[model samples]
Every structure is written in C-alpha cells, then in structure tokens.
Target chain A: MSIAEKLNTYTTGPDEQGHFGRFGGRFVAETLMPLILEVERAYTDARRDPAFKRELEHYAAHYVGRPSPLYFAERLSEALGGAKVYFKRDELNHTGSHKINNCLGQILLAKRMGKTRIIAETGAGQHGVAVATVCARFDLPCVVYMGETDIERQQPNVFRMRLLGAEVKPVTSGTGTLKDAMNEALRDWVANVEDTFYIIGTVAGPHPYPMMVRDFQSVIGQETRTQMLEAEGRLPDSLVACIGGGSNAMGLFYPFLDEPEVRIVGVEAAGKGVETGEHAASLNGGRPGVLHGNRTYLLQTDDGQIVDAYSISAGLDYPGIGPEHSWLKEAGRVEYVSATDAEALEGFKLCTRTEGIIPALEPAHALAHVAKLAPTLPKDHLLVMNLCGRGDKDVFAVAKRLGADIE
Target chain B: MSDAAVATHLAQTRLEKRFADLKAAGRAGLVTYLTAGDPDAATSLEILQGLPAAGADVIEIGMPFSDPMADGPAIQAASLRALNAGMTLAKTLDLVAAFRQADREAPVVLMGYYNPIYSMGVEAFLARAVEVGVDGLIVVDLPPEEDRELCAPARAAGLHWIRLATPTTDDARLPRVLAEVSGFLYYVSVMGITGTKSATREHVAEAVARLRRHTDTPIAVGFGIKTAEAVREVGAVADAAVVGSALVERVRANLDEAGKARPGLADDVLGFVRELAGGLTA
Candidate 1:
C-alpha cells in the first residue's frame, strides 16, 4: 500500500468519552464536571450550526485579519544553502499573536451561552491581551489571572491587557507561574459558575477545550495548504511549530495529519538545557501525570510533586503539554524535539537580520530547529514554520538578555 | 482472613461506631479538620491528640500537597507552611501513627489531593494507613468516575472512602456520587473553595434532605461553616458539620510573628474546636 493510503486509514480519535488514546479526559473536581459538560454540549451544537460558522468566518476575516500571508524567507533560505523556507505569518493578527483566533471563537461562544463575565489565565500575557480585546469588543467584563512573577516580566503585555479593560489578578502561589495562574482561574470559575465563562488559553484543559481550541486555530494550516499549493503547486516537505501546551503546533498539524508526505516537528523550550533539570520540555524530560484536568506529560518529581519549569520566554515555561501532544508522541506521528535558550536567541537574531521579521521567543525555539535542519536538507526541500507571535512585546527582555542599550 | 484484613475490619468498625454514637446522642457530630504538620510536627501532633478531648467526634487530618486547587488562600497557606517545615507523605503517616498511640477512640480521616497517595503507591499507602488507624479518606481531586483508581482499593482495604457532593450535583448526577460512597457524603455547602462565603441554613437543610432521599449514608456539611453560629446553623440540619479552615485559621492567628507556634498554640486551637462543638450541641 502507498504511504498516503496507510496514513489515511488511521482513524482520528478522542472518541465519545474524550479519550485521545488514554491521555485526555475530564479529571476535574465534581463541581466542575457539570460546567465542562455544558461547554462540550454548547460547542457540539455550535460546530453543527451553519450560522455559527458564518459568524466565525466573518470575524476571522475582518476582526482578526485572517489569511495571514505565506511569505517565503528568500534571504534565510539562501544563507542556509540547503532548503527553501517559508513562514505562516500568524503574528500579523490583530492582537499581535495567534492567540486571537481561539479567543474570538471562545468569546463568541460565551456570548451565545449568555454568559456575562469572562475569565482567563495567561503567562506571557498574549492570550490575556487577546481575550481582553475580544471582551472589550463584545462589552463583557473580563478578569485575567497571571502569576506575580509573570506580571513583572511581561509588563508590556500586562499594560496592554489593562488598556483593553481587563482586571489582572496576580497569583502568588507555587513558584508564581502559569500553573498557579491556571489553578487560581479554576478556583474562581468553581465559585462563580452562574455568570462566568472560562476562556482557556491553549489546547489543554478538560474535554472539548483541547478539541475546540485546535479547531479554532486550524485556520492557520487551512490557509497554509491553499497558499502553499498556490505558490509551489505542491505540498511542503516539512512543518515546524513550537509547543507550550501545544496549541499553535496542533493548529498547524491537525490539517496535515493524514498527508503522509508531510513531516511534522514540535519544538519544546529547553530553558538552559535538558540535562540541567531546569527546562520546560515535557516530552523530553517529563513523565505522564494528571494535572489541571487532563492526563499529559508533566515535569514532576518522583513523588508526584510538580516541579517549577524554567524558560527565558515566559510563554513556554509551563510544566505540562496538551494531552493530544502526548497521544501524538506515543503514536509516533509527530517528532518532538527541544531547543535551548541560547539556540533560541540565535534563531531570534538570525530571523531578525536575515528575514527582517522579529519573531517572538516562543517561535524562535521552532526557528532554532529549522536553522539546524535547513542546513542539512537538499536545496529543493521545502519547509514551513508557524511564526505564531510578533516580537514587539519581547524587546525589553531580549535587550536585557543581549545587553543591548535600547536608548 | 489475613492480619491486614482484620486490621481493616477494625478500622471500619471504629468509623461505624462513631457515626452510631452521634445518632444515639441526638446531636450533630463536630468533625474538626487541621493540617497534619502545619507550622511544625510537634505542635500539629499536640493539636491532633487534644481534638477528641475538646469534643471533636471525628478528625480530618490534611495531607499537605504543593498544589491544592480546590482550596482557598487559608488552606493553601497552611499546606505551604507544612511543606516548608519538611513534611512529606511518610512524615504525615508518622504523625497519624503518633496521634493513634495517644487516642484510640476518635476516628481519624486523612484529607487532601490524590497525587501524594499516587506517589506513595496505592496499596502500600492503604496498608500503612490501616496499620496506623486512619479510618477514612477524602481525596478531593478524585471523583466518582475515577473511583477505580483509589476508591475501590481503599474500600477493599476496609477504609471508608468518603466522597464530596456540591450544590452543582443535580438529581441526574447524585446517584453516581452516592454509588461508591462508603462512610458519609461530604456536602460542600457553598459552591466555592474552603474559607469562602457561608451557605444559608435553609440551603443546607434542603440539600441534606435531597441527599437523604438517595442513600442511607450520613451527610456531613462543610466549606464555610466558620463561626460558632454558622456551625450551629449547619448542625441543625446535617448529621455533622466539618470545620477545616476556621480551625486552620485559628492556628495561623496564634502563631508568632515569625510563624512559629506560640506556647499555647495547641490549647488555643483545641479551645476554638471546643467552641464549635459547643455550637453543634446547642
């Protein structure tokens, strides 16, 4: 049988009970089970309604600036002297990141459900700014829970969220990072279940969220497929994206899963190095465990205590990855790799100088791997990477790290 | 039967006897909860040993976890304090064993998240807990759907597997909650975490009445029954009133500026438990 035939025969899952090969399930509190089930029901109905699709499409084109360009990196491709490289420019979206896609979908669902309040948790604050922007557009009250440490480091995005009318609640527990912020948001949702809707930032959380966020963000791959076929008259040889809960990667990978010719690669943040025990590469340095409502690969101690994860980029400093990524890793459909902070910094600078595109540190991890692979492949090999966010919000931290004087 | 089986049977009998005694007294039971090693191990043990004498019919000893998502700031801080003082699951079991040596009549229940127990390996933790006389468990993160993970094994070991039901638990979902529930059903009075808003007396009475129709199990109301008046109100309708955060808060208030236990820390905490129990009987 042909490779495409064999791959096409593989069934897509997360069967009726929401188990993506024993990874994703509803492991939340009993109080949250009902609310989560309600969300699943609403999403199921919204997915089937044509009007909901049309309304989502309307906002995608006008509000979020959809069909983000598929730009060929001519200078970087020439410098690599091997593969031709292209970028799926999702960073050009209105909120300056790919986060606005999922936020728009969820806030629309919240409006449909008649929920009056919205709550979210953010690490780098991109998702916070996106959700806050949507809430402002819809005129809903918004509250964002951010770790105190993250609030200090990502001050520009924090200011953006407040300017867009979001109340940022600082969580000061358990290393004060992404995980603690999520815990606080869950606690808040449990308390105010009547009027509030939780807008999860990634392809994590319980049932329907992993599926819903991926479905919303899959516009990236859909556009890329059309644009690639239009530009090269054929599919790309490989695809690359960074994983922090794996939403952006999932968005770009879901559409091409059955295309056997496409090689999918997920890059993880190795803060210092994987051997240093300080990185956030769950697939590389962690084991399967239950946390934050799903079973996934987590950076935890032998005693099941969650360990603090480190990354120069606040966005990638999470201990757990999306459960679907765990399933994909086990199935061997996607190759999971890690890039250290130093390598990411190199990628950041190379992209800025060669392509004239200042990429966020999260996607710089992906670019780092692309830099490594592009030099090894043949000249005609085509590669596509998701530039998931812009770098304007990261200037201060990048400057401080590089010891550059912005003034 | 093996000696393990015999030990399990005795633990079950002790829990059954405590509930029966409460029924015989015609007054609601006072279930006092405190972190096992908050501040330090010695002060926690002193407080645990003094609970029964201070009128606590049943005690819930919190197994400190790094992440307690269902808890509010007060219990979260309590867990942090215990963890900072070098407490582990092994040390928590040791604390229970020490308390059992001093008091044999009062039933002790270990309450917390499930990861620590999972980390210890379920069978070994159950055996050790039964040996140390832990009569029941309330793993807040494990629900009825995942009962096969710990609840079934815990019940098979003859330990009472207590479950929690909230206001969100409707008629359709109540049976799943009551299906594997062994000892008593913990009815979370408020929809929030521990140490938050209080539930009204009318709501508690109504919820208990609804739960009684489903099972013969006793219902214990917890979460936000803080003051003596609130305990009295909850005790009027439920079989027991479980006070956790209020007792933990008392411990926090009595600590020195540096967070060390004051000279009369245990006495003061037990004194507050006594007042809550007094309210139950009033």
Candidate 2:
C-alpha cells in the first residue's frame, strides 16, 4: 500500500491524539498531554485555515526561502553518461541545510503555541544552528544540546548556534555524540515541559514529531513535484536521499510514495562498511532495539548495549533510522540501501569536480550511489536527489580525510 | 489466567512478584526502560505502546535528571531520549496517569538519580506517586546514609521506595538494604553503571541471603540481570528478578526489522521470563 494509505488520517477515529497505523499513538504523560493535544489541535486548525497556510507559505517562501530550487546537474549527468541527475537545493536553505526548513516551521509553531523556550539536540550542529537561528528570530530562549564529541568535530556550526544566541550545552555521557545529545535534550525537556518547545532535527522520534516533521519538510516533496512538473513536464523515474533520522528523505519522498512509477531509495551510511561495527546502516545491519524513545533498528551488541556508530559524516552516524522508514522498508514501498565511506568520498570529489557543488558528506553518500548507478541505468531515466546540506561544516573533516591541507 | 490462580500466586509486594507472575503464566513480563520524557511528550507515549504485546511487561520509566551518575551509555541515551521527550518529575507522575488508563497490572517503576526528586522535595513527590499509582521508585544514587527524605515519605504514602545494594555492600550494609527498602531490593549484581554486564549469581546469592535475614520484602536482583539465562540464575536466589538494560537493549536491538512485534518474538521473550521465574521456584 502507499505511504499515505498506511498513515492514519485521524479523520473519524483516535481524535487528533496522533496515530500512525497501530504503531503510533499518543501515550504521553498527563502534564504534557494537554499541551501536546493543544499543539495537535492548533496544527489541525492551522492546516485547515487558509490564512494560516498562507502565512506559513509566505514565511517559507520569503523568510525561510522555500521553493528551494531543483537544479539539474548537467555536468554530473554528462559525466555519468547515462542517468539524468537533478539536485533539490536544500543545501541552499537559510541555515545552509534542509534542517532549517523543519526548524523554522517548528519555531513558528512554537510561537503559535505560546512557547517561550526552545530546546533542541544536534548531531553535526546543523539542526542546532537552524533552531538557534529561528529561535533568535522569534526571540525565544533557545537551548541546544550537542554531544561533546560533535561540538568539537563540528565547531563551526557550534559557534554559529552560540552566535545566534542559543545556549549550547555539551553532553558528556554515552559515546558523547548525537545519541548522547538527544538524551540530554530529552532530560531538559522533561525538566521544563511546561513552557518549552522541543525542535527535533530528524523524523525519528515518536508520533507527532515524525508526523509533524514530515508534514513541515514535506514542502520539499510538494515543491519538488510542482517544480519537476514545470521543469521536466513529468515526474522523475527515481528519487534518492540520505537517511539520518530520515526527515530530508521523507520530505522529498512523501509526495511520490503513491507514484509506483517513481521509485524511492533511502540510502544509509555504511561507515567503513556494514561490518566491522563501524557503520550506521541500521536497516542493513542493525537489530530491533529500544533507543531514543522508539523501538527501531539500532546497532547494538547481543547483550543489548547500544554500540557506538561511526561515519565520515557525523549527520548520518546515528545507530537507528526513523520508525516510519522501518515501516516503509518492511512494507517494501521504498528500498533501503547503503553507501560506504570510500564511495561517499569518491562522490564528494566527483560532485566537486563535475558540478562544482561541494555537497555535505551526508548527501555525498547519495551522490556515491549516483556515480555507481548512473552508468548502468538508461540515459533517458531521471534521478532526483536531495542535496540536504553544504560542505562548509565538513571542510575540516573532509580535508583531513582527503589529506588536503590549507595554508 | 484464572483469578484463583493469580490469587493463589503469592502476594508479591517484594521483588518476588516478578518470579511468581512469571511462573504462573509461564512467561516473563516484558520489561521496557524509558526516561520520563527524552524528546518530548509525544514520543514517550509512542514508545509505551510499541512494547507490551511485542514483549514488555515491567516498564522501567526513567525520571530525567541533570546528573545521572549510575547509568551507562545506552541507558543514558534512553534517559536522554525520554528527557528530550519532555519528561519531568511531575511529568513522570503524569506518565503514570496515562499508564494507569491502559495498563494497571504491569508494574511501572520510576528509576533515576536522586537529584530530581530532591529538587522536587520529598513529600510532594511521594504524594504525587501515590496519586499516580506508581508501584515503585529506584533512586540510583540515593545512598542509605541519606534516604529519609525519600524513604520515610514513600513508606508513609504506601508506595515502594526500591533501593539498590551493589557488590560493594557487605554483610554489615546488606541488612540495611532490606531494613529500609520496601517494594523490592534492587541487588546490583556487578559493580558499575546501570547498563554494564556480569550477571553472576554466586556473588549475588550471598547478598540475597544476607537481605533475607533482615526484612521479608521481595529480593529482586538488577544491574546485570540481562540475558534469559542470567535471569534464571538470579531468580534461583532472589525472590524476583529485575532485568532492565538487557531487556531494553533487546527491544532497542529489534527495532526496524520485520516481524519485531510478532507473537513469536513476544513468546520467545515471555518464555524466557517464565523460565527464569520457574527457576526461582525450582
């Protein structure tokens, strides 16, 4: 069945309490229940009210800069010599990545809900920067939790978040990475559930988060559908994007889940490889376990301890994918695949050389697949990929990996 | 599943209930560990339902704190997830409110560091616990030297203030673990963080027997009680077995794969709990 059909519409049943199939339900504590229901009610009301939609549309277009262009990569396509490639320029969004799209929308919703504080967690600090940017704009007290490890690795974005007036707290527990940051963020939210709004970076969390994030980010797919129709006069043959918590991929894929003609592929980070305990390809290598709120695919040991995950790209280094991705993979509506670090490096260099676009290492994983599949597919076939972020935040890491030293 | 059988099943006020129930049903209660609110309010609820029919029985809902000294990486990750999910000490009570609506039988214990409760003030939290029908609370860092703030109030409220006795606790301190502890004595089998491994009954049996001398409260072992075999071993001595990080780790590991919530998986895990419970009786 299509993704839309699989998702609970909540028209006549379950109220607006948030239900996705039988798996998704609002089993929240009583303190936040009223607030969550309020948010759901507001979202529902806003969704139906034309004025609210128009206001959101206006901000998305003018403030956050929505309708992010879909640029066809002629050079890369020609280099590939077979498949046509198009890049959804989310990398060009306000905060330099697609993370801003969801952040801005959530910040706006926080404002509507009368939330005075904004809490967020970041892996590579992209989401932190995005949340900080919007919270600063909205004048909300923003607190961003980043793993101590990520803060050091992604220093530029960490500084950006602080500069944007968000308090960046470094989490020291666990692997001191995204997962730890997420844990700290949760602790903060629980502590201050009264007036705080949590801006989740990915589509991985529970019910309303995955659904709400997908809705906000779905603008990517919605706009892509319109833009693609205008540009190519038809839908693309295939769509692919990197899946960290899968928000970007879901945003781009939600619009085309019913178009059986348009195949969807969610690429996971293979790290060094799926083996050697160095990968984040949960669907390919992980077992089902509970981590970060939901029971989803995770990289863990036989005893159920969450193993540390590694990837050249910090953004895609999470041990679990979003539960919806799990559901989709099980349903076979979309195919889950992986791209290795070596392949991603090649794709990173290829994008730089062929298209002069220094894509983030996360999307370079998707680019790696393009390099592998383009030559094999028919020349007339088209592939649309979400260029989720720019490479600026990753320059140091990339430089170290590629042995390129700058004077 | 007869009431007679359930009634005939010993009244398990202490840790012994887990084993008693497990033996009666021939299935282990699925134990899921979560922080009160990690990401936000919505996700915490989603996680509660995701288990149960899948395998969980006892849900160890964590109360998020600024300092959780007892937890290791994965559980710390989970605690953060629950905290991020928008959990609070007050919200922890709120979680129990929702929990009571759908599930009344499965014992829900609030586990976390003592800071949040201390911050919340003992009396208010104990009252809230009674109001919310919380079965027990595990304040990991609540040393016996200074637990009157929580223990005294919790007992007055008719709630279980479960205490932990690590391998470090000796014959001198072992009796203290049972003296003040109501609900169940969470015997930390190993000397480490909440998610570490090393479930040896040989070391634990001494502690269990030591506690058995003082109070009749159920002696449930935790910390490293992870595997089914380990559960059986711990159950052989302790009145009830507390398997947390392992069960949570199992739930975490099974996510996203096909047939994760199937009856077979539930049966496999439940059967393991039952076997351990049976071992407790055997």
Candidate 3:
C-alpha cells in the first residue's frame, strides 16, 4: 500500500485532547489550561482562515526566503559512493535555521490573539534568534529563556537575539540546559498568561502546540514534496533530518508521513555515545515519560528524575523528543537513529568541504547518519537530508573543539 | 468495604471534619505547603512536624521533581535545594511517615509532577504512600482527562485524589474535574504559577461561589496567597487558604548563605506559618 493509503487506515492523532496515542496532552497546571485552550481555539480558527494563511505565506516567501532550494550534493554523494544525496537547504533561510518557519506562524497567531509579549526557550539559540527576529518584525516584546551554560557556548546567537531586542534570561536550574530553559518559559507563560504568547521552539509541549507547530512547519515537507518532484521527477527514496525537540524533523517528515515508499530517518545526538551514558538519543536511550506537558520518550532515571542530555550541538541537547515522533517510533512508521559528537563533527566538515555548506551541528548529526547509510545503499537510491541550520553560530565552539585559534 | 475503600473513607472523613470545624469556627482552615527535604531532610522534617501546632490545619508536601514547570522561582529554587541536598521521592515519603508517627490527624497531600510517582510505578507508589500514611495527593500534571493513569488508581488505593480548578475551568468543564475528585478541590486563585500574583477577594469570592454550585467539596484557594492580608481575604470565601510559596520563601530566607539550615530555621518557618494561619481567624 502507498504511504498515504496506509495513513488513511491509521488514526491521525492527537485525539480531541491533544494526545498522540497517550503521548501528548495538557499535562500542565490548571492555571495554564484555559490559556492553552485559548491558543488551541485561535489556532484552529486561524488554520481555516484564508487571510491567516495568506499572511503566513507572504512572510514565508518574502521574509523567511522559502521555499528553500533542493540541491544535489554531487561531491558529497560521489564521496559516499552509494546513494545520490540531495540537500534540502533550510540552512539558507532567514535566521539561518528552519526555526523561523514555526516562529513566523506562531508570531502571526500571537498577533491575531492580541498577545503583547512573546516568550521562547532556546538551547542552541536558533529558536531564540528566530523568535527574536519575528518579535522585532511585529514590534512585540520578546523574552528568551536560555540555559546559562548554553548562553556562554552559543554567545554569537545570544548577541544576535539581544540585537533583535530580546531579553535573554539565563536559566540556572537543573543542569541549566534546554529542558530547564523550557521549564522557565512554561513558568513565565503561566505567570504572564494575560498578555503573553509562548512560542515553543519545537513540536513538543501540550495540546495545540504540537499540532499547531507541526502544521506551521509542515511547510518544509510541503515545499520539499514539490521541489523534489521538480528536481528528481519523483519522490526521493529516503528522508533524513535531525531531531531535537524534533521540530525540524517533524516539519520535514509530516507531509511525507503516508508515503510508504519514502523511507524516513531521524537522527539524534549521541553526545560521546549512547552507551557512554551521555547522549540525547531519547528514543534510543530513554523511555516513555511525562515532562513539559507531553508524554514522550525522555532521558530520565529509574526513579523518574530527568537526566541531563549531552550533545555538542546545543539544539539537540533536549531530554525529550516531540510526542508525534514518539508515536511514530512506537508504530514503526519512522526509523530513529543516533550520531555521536565526533561523527557529527565529521559530517559537518564533510558537508563544508564537499558541498560547501557549513551546516549546523544539529543537522550535522543527520548528515553523519546519511554519511554512514549512503555508503551502504546502491548508487541509484535517492536520499534527501534537511540541512536545517547554518554553522555560523557554531564557529566559535567548533574552533575551540578543533583546537584552532580564531581571534 | 475493602481495606482500600475503608482507608479512603477515613481520609475523606478526616478532611471533611477539618473543614467542618473551620465552618463551625466561622473561619477558613490553613493549608501550608513546603518542599520536603528543603535545605536538608532533618530541617524539613522538623518544619513538617511543627506545621499543625503552628496553626496549620492540613499540610501539603511538595515531592520535588527535577522539572517543576507549575512553580515560580521560589518553589523551583526550593526543589533545586532539596534535590541538591540529595532529596528523593523515597526520602519525601519517609519524611511524611515520620510526621505521621507523631501527628496522624492532619491531612498530608503529596504535591508535584507525575514522573516521580510514575517512575516508582503507580501501584508501588500508591502502596508506599498508603503505608506511609499519606492522606491525599495533588499531582499537578495529571488532569481529569487522565484519571485512568493515576487518579483512578490513587482513589482505588484509598487516598484522596485532590484536583485543582482554576479561573479558566468554566462551568462546563468543572463537572468533569469534580467527578472523580474525593478530597477538597484546590482552586488556584490566580491565573499564574505559584508565588506570582494574588487574586482579588472579589474574584476569589466569585470563583468560590461558582465552584460551590458545582460540588459540595471543600474548596482550598492557593497559588498566590502569600501575605497574611491575602490569606485573610482568601479565607473569608474559601474553606482553606493554601499558602505554599510564602511559606517556602520563609524556608529559603531562614537558610544560611551556604543553604544549610541556620539555627531556629524550623521555628522561623513555623512562626511565619502561624502568622498566615492567624489570618484565617483575624
């Protein structure tokens, strides 16, 4: 059966309550329930409104520089010596990442809802930069919660966000990373629900957020479908994208979910290695548990305390993946894999040298997997990987890692 | 009745009697909350044991989770302090068990996120909680929609499964929330996290009046009842004025620079609790 045909038989969850097969729900304090419901209602209406769609499309085309190009990685593919690899150049988008796609949609929704304040959480700071850019464009006050540790490492993006008029609040709790940043953001949203719109940077969080974010980001897949047809004359044999909170991967994978012939692979950051007990491969290393308003695969201890996830790429340093990805993995619809920091670094260098694209470490993890899988596949096999972000923000960190002195 | 059912009935009765006594006294009851093992387990235990005598009618023990999104900076810091001091779910229940040994009548509710309880396994946690003499639970993340996951089993295990209702819980949704709820309903007075802003007395009165129409369960208003003045105002309308962040803030303030319990830290926290409880009758 075709992927579309098979999807038709399966339930397209989250049921009425935002659950992707008991994975996603409004697992929040009662104080935030009404606000979440309000967001859900506004988004549901906005989805049907042509004006909203038009506004989003206008911004996507003019502001975000979409639809991003689909380019054949001739050198990289030849180097791999198997599959013909293509690059979905989302890294070229405004704010240098795919994060702006969802931010633009959500910022528009926030305006429609009359929200005066925009808040977000960032790890690698791409989402923080995207949110800050949108807020500046709309003249809304933006506050970004980032971990203290991340703020120091992703300093370039931190300066970028502040330059865009965002107050970058450093979170100091619980290993001071993406999960803590998210917790702080959720806390802020609960406290300032009166005039705030929390632009969650990924396809995680409670109801409406996962569904709404997926819808907004599905633009990636939608564009890729058409662009791939224009380039390859048919669907690519496989799809690959990196998973943090799984937004970029979800954005790229949503439209192709039912395409049974098109294989989908999600790459997670393995840090040193999954077996080393320091990785962000939630699907590979973690189990199903509830955190940050959704039940998904989380890196948690036996006693249910969340374990700190490590990744050289700050974006992939989250403890949990999006609930849809969890469901997808459980149903065996999407294959999940992992790439270590060293492997991802190799992928980053390979893409830079071969394709002349300095990809962000997040998608470098995907490239690492692509590098491995492409070699094993036949030369006739087609593979498209989402180069989700650029590496300009990661230069300093990468330089430090490579023992290169850059003044 | 089954042993579990009987235990649940007793717990329900205990909670009801406290509220009834407050009603007869022409004032509200005080529900004081603090994170277990804050600063240190011994200091936290001392504070827990002292709450009732300090004028607390019931106690809500925060089971510190690594991620507490429902809380503001104060409670979040408290959880961090507890966790940093090596506090665990098992230790939290142990503290409660110690408290229960001396004072068995005060309704103690384990309040926090669900992962800890879930990690311990639902049945196992419930059995442990029951064995430890925990009277009720207020799992913030578990909603009425997810009653089957923990609420149903918690109730079946003979514990009062308290649910939180907020200003956003409209008349339409209140029924579902109140359906399986056994103990008093915790009404979050403000539309924010703990320790942010207090709801006006008029708003609390209106909310309490609305909640009264739906269920006869005692309503305890919390999530911003910080000051004695705010406590007094909330107490006038609701059956209980739940003070969490304000009391936890006391625990935070009374600590030394190194976050160790200073001399009379427990007394200092209990003294503040007394002042907040005094607002109930004032």
What TM-score would every model get versus the actual structure?
A: 0.95, 0.63, 0.94
- Using Cα atoms, each model's DockQ against the true complex is 0.60, 0.04, 0.69
Which should have the higher lDDT, number 1 or number 2? 1
For each candidate, the alpha-carbon lDDT, in order, equals 0.90, 0.72, 0.90
Candidate 1, residue A397: CA error in Å?
Answer: 0.4
**Alpha carbon RMSD to native, model 2:** 16.9
Q: What are the per-model C-alpha RMSD values against the true structure?
A: 3.5, 16.9, 3.3
Candidate 3's displacement at residue B77, Å, is 1.6
Query: Candidate 2 lDDT, tens digit per residue, B133-179?
Result: 68888765445543454667776777777777665555665665556
Clashing pairs in 3: A3-A258, A3-A260, A4-A258
* Better DockQ candidate (2, 3): 3
Model 1 is docked with a DockQ of 0.60
lDDT (Cα, tens digit) per residue for candidate 3, span A193-283? 8899999999999898998888888888898999889887899899999998999899889888877788999999999999999999999
Candidate 1 regions with alpha-carbon error over 4 angstroms: A1-11, B1-12
Per-residue C-alpha lDDT of model 1 across residues A1-407, encoded as one tens digit per residue: 53333344323767666678778777778888788889999999999999999999999999999989999999999988888999999999999999999999999999899999999999999999999999999999999999999999999999999999999999998779999999999999999988999999999988888889989999998899999999999999999999999999999998888787899999999999999998999999998887888778989887677888899989999999999899888877889999999999999999999989999999999999999999999988889999999999898999999999884
- Candidate 1 accuracy as TM-score: 0.95
